[model samples]
Target: MEQQTQDKSTMVVFSGDLDKAMASFIIATGAAAMGKQVTMFFTFWGLNILRKEEYVNVKKTFMDKMFAKMMPQGPEKLGISKMNYGGLGAKMMKYTMKKKNIVTLKELIEMAQDLDVKMVACTMSMDVMGITKEELIDGLDYAGVASYLADADESKINLFI
Candidate 1:
């Protein structure tokens, strides 16, 4: 009889919205808790969720500076995907979550890290978006799409958000 193994999950987080990030972490942590190895590939806007909360002083080109200025700095700065009327909707959603005693995105991120979820920042996307390693949070693997594809190939579940 062929041995059957049930484990491994991979996700491509493509959205920078707070709700989507939260969902990704929630799923990732759940899978990790269930004894599955989880990998999260953060590309494009999703990279914002891994950024540092404080400003990172790094020399950059004019375009890079502009991009850095326009993008959100960290998880707390992300807006909701819908009904975000200039960030008001995000605020309301956050307030409601707090009132309901739901876990915060930051807490979920910490939980994911503690659970040993592999988080990879897309190198190509970082270059295109003018993001530097210093601007991102620590303890992340930096790789390109091929790395994500490899993990996805071995995974039983895959998601793009």
Candidate 2:
């Protein structure tokens, strides 16, 4: 009989707002970069980031006043480091990223997808949020509770963040 080696880490479930969605991806990206299998289940607003169209429509809260004015609207407006100081924060972020050559959220999402990060959208949330599968990006993993739990149960690092 052949013995199989199990992955050291379990699943990580992320549930929350847009910022939380970005944070979750950062963690998933790190874990995957470290050679650990990562699964990011997006429910509710978190799923917005996964939508191809919404990617360009990602809006910052009132907190991004200046940034909102200078940078593009939606996720495309945010730079790496996920820092938005509220005032010149967006501009400073754009300037810093330009100086340091950092990647954008859109780029991260693309990279994560290419790396097989397992992006799943919540059917329940979709229905409630009035988002249809057609509204989501093509080629993404989409499902309901049974599907999500299938991954959640296999995960040891479950988080509701």
Candidate 3:
């Protein structure tokens, strides 16, 4: 009798507003921390998270207003945590980091890369948003729908964020 091996994979697809993007990446980072092979596919609004300038300018869109009225507008307004207040929130983050030795989001990204998490940028969305390849961070892998599909096909855990 031949034994079949099970493949463990997690596909995190980002397609929502700023909060969603932040949440998805944080989860992906957590998954990597757990020794799992993680692949993050950024598409549509999710891809905006990869835009260097937009990372700090993420905003709530029309649809966001309809449903997430209570949510903050843009990454800057979005609290560093789900439980923190406004500007005081950001201040608290710096204080806590100094107290507990935590890393910033940019540092987390670098750590994620060091952990071998694959970050794929959707080429279709990039073209639609007029974002050139050079506009993205270096080493970001650009792929088409077929590539994402292939990833989904191989992934045992596929998520559309």
Ranking by TM-score: 1, 2, 3
Among the numbered candidates, top lDDT falls to 1
Q: Top TM-score: which candidate number? A: 1
Q: What residue runs in model 1 are displaced by over 4 Å at the alpha carbon?
A: 1-5
Q: Model 1 scores what on Cα lDDT?
A: 0.94
Ten-residue segment with the worst summed lDDT in candidate 1?
1-10
| Cα lDDT listed for each candidate | 0.94, 0.58, 0.61
Inter-residue clash pairs, candidate 2: 10-156, 11-155, 58-74
- Which 10 consecutive positions of candidate 2 have the poorest summed lDDT? 1-10
| TM per candidate | 0.97, 0.65, 0.63
Against the correct fold, how does model 2 do in TM-score?
0.65
Q: What is the lDDT of residue 97 in candidate 2?
A: 63
Those runs of model 2 whose alpha carbons end farther than 4 Å from true positions after fitting are 1-19, 54-74, 77-95
The lDDT ranking, best first, is 1, 3, 2
Q: What lDDT tens digits, residue by residue, belong to model 2 across residues 1-161? A: 01111232333333433345456767677766766556776665465565554433443355433432443223543333345555355567656666897765667777777777777777777666655566567667778778767666655566666
Model 3 Cα lDDT, one tens digit per residue, 6-94: 23345545554434555576777887787767778776656545555443323445553343334333333434435455557566765
